[model samples]
Structure formats: C-alpha cells, structure tokens
Target chain A: MIEGHDLDYVVSGIQTLHRVSIRAEAGEIVCVLGPNGAGKSTLFRLLSGEIAPRAGKVTLLGHDVTTTPKDTLATMRAVMPQESVLSFPFTAFEVVMLGRTPHATAGETMADRAIARAAMAATDSLAYEDRTFSSLSGGERQRVTAARVLAQIWEGEEGRALLLDEPTSSLDLLHQHGLLETATTMAERGCAVVCILHDLNLAARYATRVVVLQEGRKVAEGTPREVLTRALLADVFEVDARIFVPEGTEIPVVVPRGPLSKTKPPRLATGALL
Target chain B: MTMAEAPTSRPTPRAVARPFAWATSRSFVLAAGCLVVALSVVLGCAVGAVHVPPLEVLQSMLGLETPHREMLMSIRFPRVALGLLVGSGLGLSGASLQGVFRNPIVDPGFLGISTGAVLFAVVAVVLGGHGAVSTMRTALGAPLLLSAAAFVGALVAMLSVRWLATVEGRLSLTALLLSGLAVNTVAGALTGVLLYAATDVQVVTVTFWTFGSLGGATWGTVLRVAPIFALGLVTLPRLGRSLDALVLGDAEAGHLGIPVERTKLLVIVVSALLVGAQVAVSGLVGFVGLVIPHVLRLWAGASHKTLLPASALFGAALVVLADTSARIVVKPAELPLGVITAALGAPFFLALLLKERRRLV
Candidate 1:
C-alpha cells in the first residue's frame, strides 16, 4: 500500500506538483492519465522516495517514507523510470540481475538468479537473455527494464507497489496489452500497481481505477466509466470527442472528433449544444 | 500463459546457460588475468639489462644463488614489485572512475586529477632546488610530504570540478568533463611558470617527472606507496554491486538501493588515493590505466565486478612488460617509462578511436 497526502513538489523554483493526494492499495491497478508535464512523473518520483514532497507526507506500507532509509523502502516497492540509458554493454540477464542487488549481501545467490530469470520469462524477454541491452530494440528494451523492476519485487508479499512511468509508450499494441496483462497479474498476486499512460481506452480496459490530471492538479478520480466521460475529456484534454458504449458494457470507448476548431464549432449528434 | 509450478525453483539461467560467455563470467577472466600476471611477473623478473632465463629468475628468487643474484635482488626485484604495485593502482583507479562516470573514455586522470598531482610534485622539486640525481634520491625520503601534497592537490582539483559540475546535488557529466579541461589548463600553466623559475638542475628534475619514469624504483619507495594502494584495492571490490547498478544512471541506481552520492564520493576518494600515490612514486606513467581496462572490457565484457580486478592484473602485467622493455630496448641508457608506455598505448588508442570513429565525431 502507498499513499501520498497533499504532496507538493518544486523543480527549479517552479511548482510542478500542487497539493496532490493519491493512494494505491493491494490488488488494484491505478492508472494516472494526463497531458504533457502533468506531474505524473513527479508524483512517481515522490512516491518512490527519490525526492521529498515539500507539503505532504508519503507513506509506504504504513511507514513514513520521507524518513525511511532507501534500502529499507527498496524491498517493498520497485520503480521503472522513463528511460534507462546505459553506456556499458550489459547483457539483458545481467541487467535484470541488478534488480536482486538489494537482497543479495554478497554475490548473487542461486535463489536470486532464479528470481531474475523468472521475471525475464514473465516479461517474455527470456529469448533475449543473452543479448546486450544496448542492442535491443526500443520495445524490447522497455520490456527488459520492466523485467528488471519486476525482479526487484518478485518475491515480496502484500504491501508492495510497482510504479511505472509510461511503460507502454514505445510498445506496439499487442505488447502494450501484454505488459498491462503482466501488471494485472502482479496486482492479482497482491501488489499495488500504478502506471502513467497516454492512451485512454487502454486505461479503460485495464485500469480498475483512474485519476485524471490537467496541468499539475487532479481533476477527476473514480472508476474508468465514471471519470472518463465526454465532458471530462473536453474540459481537461481540450478536445472534442465522442463517447461510445458497446452493449452489455459500462466502460467508455472514447473516439476523438478531431481538435476543437476555432472557425467552425464542434458538432454534436444530439444537435442541442450546437 | 500458465504460471510455473514452483516460482522460486526456476532454472538458474545465468549459470545454466552461456556458461562460457566471457563477458558475464567473473571467474574465467579473473583466472586468465592471474595467469597472465604470473607470466608477466616472471618475465619482468627475467628480462632486464642482464637477460636471466625464467628458470634462473625463479631459482634466484627462491634463494638459490646464481651468478646474477645480486643484480636480480637489488635492481630488478624492487623495480618489478613497484611496477606491479603502481600498475595495479593505476588500472584499478581508472576502471573505478570509468565505472562511476559511466563513460568508457574516462580515466583516473579524467578530472585533472593527475595534473594536480604533477603540479604539486613539480612544486616540491622546484622548491627543493637541487641536482636532478640528488633530488630524485632524497625526494623519496620526504615521502609523506610529497604524497600528502599530491593527495591534497588531487582532492582539491576533484572537488572543484565536482563543484563546477554539480547543481542542487545533481552532477552533470558534461559540466564535469569541461571543468576538468579548464582545471587541467590552469594547472598546466602553473607548472609552466614553476618550470621557468627553476634552476637548470631543477628544470631537469621537473622535466624527468613530467614525462613520467620508474627509474627511481626502490624498496623504500615501493613500501611507502604500498599502503595507499592497498587502501584503494580494499575499498573498490566492495563497490562492485553499486557500480554495476550505476550503469543504469544515478537516479536509477539510487532506486536500486545504492546511495548514489556516497558511492560517487567513495569512488573519487579511492581513485584519488590510487592515482595520487602512483604519481608520487612513479610520476605520470601514461595510458597504463586507460589502455588496460579498455582492452579487458573489449575482450572480456564490461562487468565491473571482474573488470576492476582484471584491470589491475592486466595493468600490472603491461607495465612490467613495458618497464622491462624500457631497460633492455636501449641497453646502456634506459628510456623514460612513460615514453615506452606511450609508444605502445598510442597505437592501441588510435585503433580504438578509429573503430569508434562514428561515436567520436
């Protein structure tokens, strides 16, 4: 479990996060959706204990993370950053084995190796275990990094959280679903999972709960059906969209009607607003 | 896909598969490095002004007195030991620095560290004001003063470079390398002024050191420098995991439970100790650090767990071989150790640069 209360963060004298509060519990997938610079990464950083929030408290597994030692917090949560830039030519296996660093006191143990390999296999990256990380394609590299963080929390019990920043950005459609499916499995095994994503339908399909952000503040928070309405998209994303609900489903499938034109206003099928 | 039966009982993929992958296996490279180092140590002991055979060298070393025993014990042994020590120090320091910086091109002297040490050494020589030969013998007597001066100089320069490159606790590699360039130029200018003010004998002494040499190798100097090198060797191996984690960059390394700032400090301090100590004893033996670690990485892969130690072995071997060549290549008159190292290093470096030309431009 992870909770952020009224979190405020400043970067380079500019307020990037403004009194943001959010929480994640075990067995749930929470997706944060926003435009560029919506403080999604900043929020992840604060939750991961990389930076302290000026105005709020962040607690992980009931301990105040601001004062908690990083090594102690490490075993409870794993964070996969936006980009993993490496100059050294480490094999994918070696890169993932780095995830077991916090646990292993000396060199790697047999158990650590098993966990790393299992995580790689889970991410469908076992085929590239011998390949150098730098030689992998973008999607492959992203998945390998995901495997690394997964290996970090592979054996943890409840109260563990996985924070992913744009995990599927480089992934193709099928791989995107596969990555989210893996995250869902992780949640099923009693882990709190939070992902920041750009695609709305993906969020609607995978996220049990969604939080919408505009600029740096949270505008709406609820289940995917309640929060991702046509009105919310228009007001927050500044776009005209059609919301489609297929039969026997409550999940909203959003279809964009292009940008809100200045010369010619948006047309609605209802015809009342025009 | 179905979950595996026992998650924890999965195959140990790292060991079970690609068992001979030289890059990832630590023991193989370490064993090879030890073997090569052992061969080079024997070779260093054998090939000198007097070409004692390897069997004779071993026999003399094991207390079986040969006709060349006196020469072997007095001149060749101390020189070989010092070469091993200094070479290992330089190699390990360079590897650690490159790992911390996450740039293969970096060396122990990357932050103008060696320049600072050279500046202080030149200052000590100019202030001593004696004949080059006499100064060389006695400077080893004031080992504390000289080593302290060099260490302080390196620490100050490194800190300044760090200060210049750091903003709000985050380090910028671009700024760090640029500041290193700036500091090196200023130190070079200072050294030039000292050289200009020096007497003729002092000029000769300063010039000898600036070009770097192991001609002054003695048991006393080797003993004086050993403890510092030992300190670095002890600290570096423990940093293997953190350095490996650092390949992912600072922020991500921290996420992996490494204290990034502390690790960087530890690397800098150990690097300074090793480089400063080597400069204090052997002057600036160029490229042993840069060339050895790179060759090892190219041949055996870039795992720092082995890269750091293997570099020490290869570096010691190369230096020993080069120093041995320095003695015999010009029989009666020995070449400066630095010249020989540069002769070997320059071509290898050029080859590497040509191979990496696309990235360089």
Candidate 2:
C-alpha cells in the first residue's frame, strides 16, 4: 500500500538516504531495523510525507504522495509521530478525538465518538479519558497517541496504512509488546503497517518481513530467520551477538554479547553530532 | 495490559458519560455568557450620570416612548455597541492567534498592531497641521483621517512581520514572534521620539490616546467599524476545528490533514485586520484579548469550538461593564477604558501565571 522508489534524501548536501527503496503491501507488517544514524528515520519521514526525498517518488495507496492533497492522504493513512506536545489543556479523550477530523463533516458525531472510544479502549487508555494529556505519564501519553492514530483509520477497510515511528520508545515492557501486537492486529485487518523498531526480537516475532539498513544503505531484506544472523549483526550493528531458534519455533531470538571494540560513535549524515 | 487484547469493543459507560457531561456544561456556559451580555448591556445603559432605570432602558430598547429616549439611543446605545464589537473582535483574535502560534501568552499586541496604531495616531497629532491644537481640531472634525492613518500603520506592521517571518513559503512562529518584537520596539522608539518633541498639549493628547477610551464612540464611528468586526465575527468562529488540530504542533496537525501553512496565514491576516480596525476606532485597549480567552480556556476546557464563542460573549460583557464603570466611577471625570481593564486584568494575569508556573517550567 505504501512504496518508495530509489529514494535519495540529502541534508545540507550530504546524502542521508542513498538509493534506498522499501514497500509494505496490504496485510504486511514491515519492520525497519537499524542502529542509530542508519537513516531509518529519514526513510520513515520520506514515506510518511513529512519531508520530500531529493530524488525519488513515494506512492501511497495507489497515489503519488508528493502530488496528492494532504486531506486525501490523511483519510487513507494515519501516522503516529515519535512525540506529541499539546499546547493547550486538552483531555486525553479530546486528544484522541482529533483523529476524527478527517472524517468529521461539521463536528464530531456519535459514531466518531464511538470509534474514538473504541480506539482508546484498544490501546488501554480509556481509564484516563478525563485526565489532562500533559499530566499523564510518558507511557500513558504514548498509548493515548497510539489510540489517536488507530481512531483515525478505524472505519477504513482495505488499502489503509499505519506508519508508526519509534512508538514503543517510552512504553514499558508490557505496553511495548501490546503496541506491537496492535500493529500486528492492524496488519491482519489488511492495513499496511510499517514500524521503525529497536527491539530486534519483538520485530522478529511480530514482523512479516524485515528491512535492515546500515550507513544509509539497505544491507538485508528477508524473513526473520533469513536476515538475522550473527555475522550480519557483527557487520551492520558492530556487536557480538547470537541468534537462537527455540525448538519447534521458526522465530529467531537475538542475544547480544557485547559491542565490538571497533565500534564507532554514530554520527548524523551531516557529520555533526547534533 | 492484556497479553492478547480482545477486539475493540463498545465504549464503557464512563467513557460515554464524561463527554456528555462536558457537552451539557458547555451549553450551560454558553447560555450563561448570553445572560451576562444581556445584563451588562442593560446595566451599562442604566448606570450612567442620568441614572435611567433598568426598566426604562429595557423599554427604550423595545422601542417604547421614554423620557431618556434620545440620550439612550444616540449616546449610550452606540457606545455599548462599539464596546461589544471591539471587545469581541479582540477576544476572538487573541484566541485564534494563540491557537495558530501554539502559545497561550500570545495576543494581538504580540503582532505589533497596537504599537503601530499608537505611533501613527501620535504622528497624526503632531504633524498633521501647524500646531497640536489645529491637528486636534482637525481630528475632531474629521475622525476618519486619524482612523485611516492608524489602520494603514497596522497594515504596514503586519505585512512587515509576515515578510520577515516567512522562510521558504512557510510561516515560522519563532521568526514571527521575533519580528513582531522588533517591529514593536522600533514603533515604540519612534513614538518616544515624537513624544519628546511634542508640546505639552500634544503630549497629553498622545498619552490619552494610548490609554484608550470609548468616549469618542459615535454613530458614524460605530457604522464605520461594524463591517470589519462583522467580518471577523463571521470568519473566526468557523476556524474552531482547524485551530483545535493546530494545538498539536504543525507537523502532527498536518498528519491529521490540516493545511497548516494556509491556516496559519489565514489566522494571522484575519487577526491583524480585526485588531487593526479595533485600534483604529478605540485607541489601544489592553488585556481584554489576552485575559478573556485565557480565562475562558481555564473555565471551559481548551476546545476552540467552545472557547472562541464563549470568549466573545464574556469579553463583550466585560468591556461593556468596564466602560460603564469608566464613565460613572469618578462621576463627571472618567477613567480611560484601557486603565480600567489593565487595573483589573494585570493582577488576574499575574495570579494565573503564578498558579501555572510549574506547568510552564
């Protein structure tokens, strides 16, 4: 449902993403994994239409993202940004209700409210519906934001896309799994789900496919068992790691030993620490 | 948290009940705001030097014959109407501008509209003729000239700020605030220069204009400013949903399908026009814009749909009441409308800041 072709993104004349291409078809959970500064976020930004790639095209749900109007794109896809800061004192429920803006005609309707509530329930955030969003804990706020995006595409059928960027960063252990499970459920519902993740085991468990990036280049793309190897981990992530598959299970579990002695500090594509 | 959650279910009763509660409360607040506006209008018309009773004012409003018919219709009614328009316009402008900038502290003054108007009005006082007295007489003779000068000055400042703040076709909020600050400082400095060079009478006129008053409200002035205020009243409230989306930073608002740049531009232009016309008619009325919306946000949650209209109604009532007190507090001598509002609003604003200091930090 979402695809990028020969994407080349340059920042300050330095190539951040070089000839990278990725796609997530309907009913597929494509998890993108990379170390810090591996151009994963730059790729996500290009696909989400937050920034335009310098030399490529992004197609979402059969339309070119660059030429399509934002309102039209919004109805077909929902993006959960890394962080959301509400300037006003909106309640958690009110924050989720904003996701209905694309479908709402005049104001919020009973159906919109119902869908928003269902989304909040799905994310387990309904308990704090009346709490001020800013007053919520970080994990609670992340769940509320997740519900917002889920509410956005709640009514849509096939051909929908959900793009999540580091959604589990502030989540606790249980919620991290819960949010990925939600993404898996969305994929099962025939929505294209593309998530950028740091937890390799969670990605291995939940993702139908994986795309690994290293230094602005795609190094591997395959199933969890095919792509995740100890040598690949050493080469790309600069870490000594072991990949073990439990009995009767095709899922690969990654266990890190330690960082390689030649590990280089991650640097932005612009060569600036900032 | 569940290991494997069930499929999404219907909202629980608690989930359904709270929104309904807010809905009912919002309606109640709106109704109360209407009542407040009505009471203030009647009280303002009745409490002047003549002391026309409320029953008499109501009868006059209903077109019945009364002893104070001419005084009520010609003088008090127009003054009240002007107050209603200017106050509501300022209130609406402040709320929408705050939404666009995603900052609660911003107001029309942050756009330099008030300073620009003051500077231009002072210039018209000092340099419009041979001496300050002749210019004052001319201004009294033809009020449009001064109003037009002030409006033009406001437009100039708005355009300059817009130009300076635009970076590659997008409005940068930080750049906008910095440019507005720069414009205000320059205008204030120029006004200071004019004040330093002015005669005593000219200085008094300039100072009084800065203090703001509704004493100059006439039928002509009311009619002249009505269309602009009406334009704002019609357009600003319609932006409630867009403004709500904008409270989340611009990028997220865009993800929700809002045309963030266009919305920001529209808000800036409309707010500038509203504030410019207000300053043109009534000299720099302070704090009604900032305090009205902030208070409304605290009372009725921050949904712009409810906050915008509520601010308009309560702001109208507050200004009408303030103007009434301005006329009657000192009996024959009157305080400036701006003075009364500042005296009331500044302390309230300080208290609010103190209460919200932790959140702000």
Candidate 3:
C-alpha cells in the first residue's frame, strides 16, 4: 500500500542522521533501534512533518510531502509524542477528541468512539475516559496518548501512518509490552506503524524489519535475525549484545553484552532520565 | 461545583446545551442592542436640571414637534452615542486580544497599548492642538485629537510589541508578555509624568480621559471609531477555529492545518485597531477583556468559535451597563467609567478566581 517513488526518507545536514534512508512496506511494523542520541526521534519528526528536512524528500502515500500543509500533510498519519502534558487541564475524552481533527464536522459515529474505547481498552485505560488527563499516571498518560493517535486514523482506511516517538520511554515493563501489543495490533489492521525503540529486544521481537541508525545515518536494515547480530550491535551501537534464537520462532532474543553495570561514576549521581 | 450548590445557577445539560448555548450567545448581543437604544434615549433625557421621560426623550431624539427637546437632543444624544460606541469598541477589542493571546489574564490595556494611546491623547488635550482658542473648543476638539492621537499611539505600541515578541519566525509567549509588561510600565510612567506638567484645566481634561468618560462622547467620535469596530467584529469571528487549534500549542495548531503565522498577524492587527479606536475615545478601561473571557470560558468550553463572539457581546453589555450605572448612580454628579469598571470588575474577578481556586495561579 505504501507506493511512493520516494518511499525512503533522506535526512541530511544533521550530526548523525545526515545520510539515513529507509522504507517499510504496507501492513508492516518497522522499528528503528539505536543508542541514545542516535537521532531516531529526529528522523521520526521529519517523517511526521514536525521538522523540515534540510535536503530530503519525504513522500507519503505517493504524494510529495516535502512542503505539504500540516493539516493536509497526512490526514491519517498520527504522531504520539514522548509526553502529552497540557498547561490547561483537559479531560481524557477531550484529549482523545483531538484525534478527530482530520475528520469533517467532527462527526462522532458509534464506530469512532468504539475505536477510541477499544484502543483505551487494549491499553487498560478504559477507566480513564472521563478522568482529567492531568491526573493520570505517567504510564496511563502514555496509553491515553496512544489512544489519541489511534483515534487520529480513520478505521479500515488504507495508507494510514502511525509514528510513535519512543511511546514506551516512560512506561513500566507491563505497560511497555502492552503499548507494543497495541502497535502490533494496529499494524495487523494494515497500518504502516513506525516506532523508535531504545530496547533492542523490543525491536527484535515485534519488528518485521529493524532499521539501525548509527549517527544520523541508516546503518543496517533487515529482519531481527539478519541485522540484530552480535557484531552489528557492537559495531553500530558500540555495545556487545547477545542474540538468542529459541525454537519454533522466527524472532531472536536480544541481550546486551555488558555485565549490566549498576554502579555510577564517583563524580555523577544516578538520576532520572528526562 | 454543580448547580445544586448554587441555587441561582442556570445550568444547561449537555443534551440541550446547544440551544441554551445559542441563547447565551445571543443574550449579550440582545443586551448590547437594547442598552444602546435605551442609553441613547436616556442620555437625551439627562439634560442639566430636568429629567426627560423615556418617550419625551425618544421624541426629542427624533427631532419631532417638541418645544424644548432641541437642546436636549442636540447636546446630550451625541454624548450618549459616543459612550455606547467607545464602550462597545473597548469591550470587543479586549475580547479579541484575550482570544488571540489564549490567556484569560490578557486585557488590551495590560500590553501598554492603552497607556500609549492615553499618553498621546493627553498630550493633544494639554497642547490644545484642536485650536484651544478655536470657537467650538469644548465639543469638537476633544473627539478629533483624542481619536487621532489614540490610533497613532496604538499603532506604535503594537508595532513595538510585535517586534519584541517575534523571534525566529514565531511569537514567543514569554517574550511577548514580558515585553508587554515592560512597555506598560514605561508608558504608564510617561503618562504620570505628563500629568504633573499639565495646567489645572488640562489636568482635569486629561484626568477625565485617563479615568474614562462618555460625557465627551460625540457623533464625530462615533463616525471615526465605527468602521474600526465594524472591521474587528467581522474579522475576529472567522479566527475561532484557528484560535481553538492554537490552544493546543503552535506545533499542534500547525499540524491541524491552520495557518498559524497568518492567523497571529490578523488577530494582532484587528485587536490593535479595536483598542486604538476605543482608547482614542474613552481612554483606558481595564479588565473587561481579562475578566469577560474567563467568565465565558467557565460556561462554554475553550472553543474559540463560541467564546469569541460570546465574549464580544458580553463585554459590550457589561461595559454599557457599567456606563449606565456610572451615569445614574451619582445622579447629578457622574463617576469616571474607569472607576465603575474597576469597582465592578475587581471583586467579580477575584471571586471568579477564588471559586476556581484549583485553577488559579
């Protein structure tokens, strides 16, 4: 379904993502895995039209979106940012209602609310529908934000895009897997879901194709078994990782090669990552 | 808090919220229209010593066959009309500025726009530039110079704020508000300095201008400020959706297909024109823009499509009603419109903030 001449994305003039180019086919979950500051978020912003490329073309659904209007850029493409904190307190239902912006007259068919409810239900956030969004926990907020993005896309509509910029960054393990499960479900529904992941294991498990970014460049692109090798992890990520292939599964299990150092350097204290 | 806690509350359910919303929407418009009509006639009846009945005031206002109505109609009707025009203009302009800034705390005056206008208008009045020694000095000169000085002052202030606020192709809220505060402080200092140097009569004239009055309201003032208000009224309603999107933040507004930069420009320009014309006539009347929107938003959700028009109407009604009370409260004597606005606005605003203590800063 993704049939654009420039299906690949080219990000230039940046530190690391200057020469990155990648493409994922229709109905596939494409995950980008890289170390911190690998510019995964930058690449996603370019694709989402939040940041303009210095010298590149981003085509979506066969249309040149290099300079497309934000409203018309991707009617079905939804971006769930890292965190959705509002200065004003808006209800969860109200926050989710923003996803219907692309739809005309803001019509609320039974099916639309059902999709929002279903997304929330999948994330175990159905109870949050009538609650103030500000009062939700971090993990619950992420789920609500994910539900909002799901609402952005028209159901059963082809050529829809889901751009997740580290949706599980602030989530617990359970919520993290739950979010990925929802993303996989969305891809099963024929969405071209692209997510940036900090966890290599997550990329290997759910991603049909894993694109690795070194600096601002695309280093490797292939299936979990093809790209998630020990040498590739060490060479690209500068950290050794062990790839395990269990029986009766095409996906490989990824474990970082380090002994998992917990001690912080004397000069720096362990702090929460922003 | 639900309506059960407040007996007088007119709470409309969500199922029938639409029609009640429509009625609340038109109530302000209807109130403003009625106020204008009633005040014009009441103003005609309010000559020096005698109290003209509403009917006699109307007859005199129309120039029908009446023996002594000529002086009342010719002299007082202009004052009343000017008051209405200035009041309506100020209220609407303040509403637009509040909407554009997306901050309920914003008023047209808070940005120092009115200070600039008042400064120039005061200077014009002090200098007696309308041929102070001219024959029709009292009636003609005030409106002419006041409106002119006001427009020029407003343009400069807005242009300065716009220049200060714009950085890297976007208006930074922090910078915009900070610059406004700075300019307001400076302009206020200058106005105070000017007040000290004025002659006794000039001081009184400028004092009235600062405090605000429709006593000097005139047809010529209306003619000058009318088109500005008309343009603001027309252009602001179309920006509702854009403003609604802006509440989500600039990036979000952009993502929603609204032309953010263009929308900001239009809002700033129209708001400036409204404030400029209003200040030229009535001087600086604070808090209507700030308070009115907060009031409406509590009732209506933060939807700009409903908020802007509703704020405009409610702002007009509030100001006009304030002006009416200013006229009749003291009976033979009159209070400056500013005093009335402040007296009414301050307590109400405080209560509003208190009621929503959870949301207050």
Candidate 4:
C-alpha cells in the first residue's frame, strides 16, 4: 500500500538514505532493521511524506505522495513518530481522539469516541484515560501514541497503511510484544504495516518480511529465515551473533555474542568519534 | 486479545461517561462568561460619572425614556461596546496566536502587534496634520484609514516575528520570545522618533492614546471596528481543530492532515486585522489577550474549541469591567484603560514566568 522507489535523502550535504527502494503490500508487516544512523528513520520519513526524497518518488495507495493533499493521504495512512512533544496538558483520551482528525467530521462523534476507547484498550492505555499525557511514564506515553495510530486506522479498510518508527524504544518487554502483536493483527486485517525496529528477535518473530540497512544503503531484503544470518549481522551491525532456528519452526532467534573487533572506533556523520 | 475486540463490543460505561464531563463543564464556562459580559455591561453603564443605576440602565437598553438618555446612548453605551469589542478582539487574537505558535505566554501586546498598530496609527495622526485627532470623531472615513494603516503595520510585525523565530521549519520558543522583544523595542524606538517631531497638542493626543483608552469610543468608531472583530470571532473558532492538532508539533500535526503553514498564515493575518483595528480604537491595552486566554485555559483546559470562544466572552467582560473601574477608581477624572489592565496583568504575567521557568530549566 506504500512504496518508496530509488529514494535518496540528504541533510547538510551528507546523504542519509541512498537508492533505497521498499514497498509494503497489504497483509504484510515489513520490519526495517538497522544500527544507529542506518537511515531507517530517514526512510520512514520519506515514506510518510514528512519530507520529500531528493531522488525518486513515493506512492501511497497508488497516488503520488507529493502531489496528494495531506488530508487525503492521512485517511489512508497513519504514522507514529519516534517521539512527540505536546505543548499543552491534553488528557490521554484527548490525545488518542486526535487520531480521528483525518476522517470527515467537524467534531468528535460517538463512533469516534468508541474507536478511540477501543484503541486505548488495545494498547493497555485505557487505565489512564483521564490522566494528563505529560504526567504519564515514558512507556505509557509510547503506548498512548501507539493507540493514537491504531485509532487512526481503526476502520481496517483495504489499502490502508500504518507506519511506526521505533515504537518499542520506550516500551517495556511485555508492551513491546503487545505492540508488535497489534501490528501483526493489523496485517492480518489486510492493512500494510511498516515498522522500524531495533530488536532483531522481535522483528524475526513479527515481521513477514525484513529489510536490513547499513550506512544509508539497503544491505538485505527477504524473509527473516533467508536474510537474518550471522554473517549479515556481522557485516552490517559489526557484531558477533548467532542465529538459531528450532527444528519444528521456521522462526529464527538471534543471540548476539559481542561487538566485532575493528581497526578503528565508529565515527558519526560529522566525523566525531564515538 | 479481549481488548482487541473492544471496537466491536460496547465500551466501558466509564469510557462513555467521560466526554460528557468535559462537554458540560465547557458549556458552564461559556454560560458564565455570557452572564459576566452582561453584568459588566450593566455595571459599566450604571456606575459611570452620572451614576444611572441598574434599573435605569436596563430601561435605557430596552429603549425606554430615562433622564440620562443622551448621556447613556451617546457616551457610556458606545464606550462599553468599544470596550467589549476591543477586549474580545484582544482575547481572541491572543488565544489564536498562542495556539498557532504553541506557546501560552505570547500575545499580541508581547509580540509587538499592538505596538506596530500604534506606530502606524500615530504616524497617520501626526502626518494627517493638526486636526487629525479630532477628525477621528467627526470625519467618516478617517477611522477607516487609521484602521487600515494599523492593520498593515500589525501584519508586518507579526510576519517578521514569525520569520525570526522559525529555523528549519521549527519554531523555537526562545527565539519567538527574543524576536518579540526585538520587534517591540524597534517599534517603540520608531514611535519615540515620531514623537520627537510632534507639536505639544499632538504629543498630548499621542500620549493619551498610547496609554490605551476606550475614552475616544463613539458609535462611529464602534461601527468601524466591530466588523473586523466579528470577522475574527467567526473565523478563528473554526480553526480550533487544526490548532488542537498543531499543539502536537508541526510534523505530527501534518501527519494528522493539517495544512500547517496555511493555518499559521491564516491565523497571523486574521489576528493582525483584529489587533490592528482594535488598537486604532482602544490603543495598546496590555494583557487582555495574554491574561484572558491563560486564565481560560486553566479553567477549561487547553482545547482551542472551547478556549477561543471562552476567551472572547471572558475577555469582553474583563475589559468592560476594567473600563468601568477605570472610570470609577479615580472618580469623575477616569483612569486610562491600559493602566488598570497592566496593573492586573503584570503580576499575573510574573507568576506565569515563574511557572514556565520550571519547565524551561
């Protein structure tokens, strides 16, 4: 439902994403995995139309993202950014209701409220419905935000897409699994789900397809069993890792041993040593 | 898994009950606001220099004959109406601008919108020659010209401040405050330069006007500026949803399908028009916009849908009541409307600064 073709993005004369082409079709959970500064967030931004790619184009539901009206695009897709800073002290329920903004209505209706409540329940955030969002813990806030995007695409209409950026970063282990299971549920409902993830095992467990990135380039793309090998992890992430697939299952479990030895320490884009 | 099916199943009773709570509270605030405006208007008319009494004031409003008919209709009524318009205009502009900027502290006065309007209005009066001040009352087209000039000035100042605060599509609150200070300083300096060249009579007129008053209010003045204020009142509330979306940073607001830049532009222009026309009639009334919205937000929460209209009503009442006190505080001599508002608003502003300091630090 969402496609980015030959995408190239640059910031401050440095390329952040180069020649990256990716697509998520209906009933697919495409997990994008990469190390720090691997251009995953940049790719997410490009697909969500937050920023235009310098080269190539993006299409969502068969319409050019750049040419489409934002209101029209919003109805077909919902994006959850890595972090959101709210200026005012809106209640969690109010924050979730914002997800229904793209729908055609002047104000919140009974149906919108029901959908928002359902989304909150799904994310385990209904317990704090009346609490101010700023008062919530980091994981609580993350789940509330997750509920917002879920509320946005609650209709489960065909050709819809949900794009999540590092949604699990602030989540605890159980909620992390809960959020991914929700994504899987969305995929099963015939919605395209593109998620950027840091945990390989979670990606391996939930992703129908995996796209791995290394230094602004797409290094691997296939099913987790075909693409998530120890050699790929060593080459892209610079880590010694083992991939174990149990005898009865096709799912691969990744266990990292340690960082791979290198001649030099890692450097940032600005050449600052880390 | 049970939660996943909640969309099709009935929501908890508590979930169904909560939205009504906010809705009812909002309605109460709005209703109280209307009552306050009515009471302020009555008190404003009755407690003036002539002391018309509430009964007679109500009679006068109903078009009955009273001893103070000419005084009430010609002087006090227009003044009270002007106060309402100016107060509500400031209040609405402040609320809308604060929402658009996503900052609670910034208002028309702080951002130099009022000063810009004053600068241009002063220039029009001084350049229009010796009789221009009096012409504002007598000449039909003079107030229109002055309002237009003020509108242009306000638009320029608002746009400049927005431009200075924005970097890489992000609006920095620190930059917004600093740029506002810069704009206010430059506008004040320019007004000072104009004052240096004025006659003694012009100086007196300019000084009194700059202090901000509804003393110059007339039916004609009210007629001229009321349409602009009404226009803002109608249009700004419609933008509440967009502004609500905007409170969640720009990119996220866009993700919700708001046209962020366009909404910002509309807010700027409409608020400029409101403040410009208001300043032309009421001078630089400080803190009505800032204080009104801040107070309303505290009472009604931060949703602009309620905040905008509530600000308008409460702002009108506050200004009208302030104007009445301005009339009675010094007794028969009348204080400038700006002095009373500043007296009330400055300390409130200080307290707000302290509250925000915790967050900033």
Off by over 4 Å in 1: A262-274, B1-24, B109-111, B128-134, B162-178, B355-361
Per-model TM values vs. the true structure:
0.92, 0.91, 0.78, 0.94
Candidate 4 runs further than 4 Å off: A263-274, B2-24, B130-141
Ten contiguous residues with the weakest lDDT in model 2 chain B: B1-10
Per-residue alpha-carbon lDDT of candidate 1 for residues B63-138, written as tens digits (9 for 90 to 100): 9989889888888888899889889988898888888877776654557888888788778777754543236667
lDDT by residue (tens digit), candidate 3, B1-361: 2111121112322222345545444355446556655654465355444566667776776768776676665656666566555655665666566556655556667677888777777766655543461222362344555666777777678778768977885556667767888888888788788767666666666666678766666566667667778888888876776776666666666665667779888887777677767776676687777777776666655556666776666666666667767777777788888888888788876785565455433
State residue A221's C-alpha deviation in candidate 1, in Å. 0.6
True contacts kept of each: 0.43, 0.52, 0.15, 0.53
User: Model 2 misses residue B236 by how many Å?
Assistant: 0.9
Q: How good is the docking of model 2, as DockQ?
A: 0.43
* Local accuracy of candidate 2 as per-residue lDDT tens digits, B41-63: 99989988889999999999999
Instruction: Record all residue pairs in model 1 with backbone atoms less than 3 Å apart, i.e. clashing.
Output: none
Model 1 TM-score on a 0 to 1 scale: 0.92
Q: What lDDT does candidate 2 reach at residue B284?
A: 77
lDDT (Cα, tens digit) per residue for candidate 4, span A1-274: 7899999999999999989999999999999999999999999989999999999999998899988999988888999988777878788988999999988357788999989988988888887888889889999999899999998888956899999999999988888888888888888787899999999999999999999999999999999999999999989988899999999998999999888877246656874554
Best prediction by lDDT: 4
Q: For residues A1-274, what per-residue lDDT tens digits would candidate 3 score against the true structure?
A: 3322222334343344565676656678899888777778777777777666665566777665555666775365777788865544456766776666565334446766656655555656666576678788888888778777777774755677788888888888877877787777678677888889888888888899988887666788899889988888767766656788999988888887563234323444457443
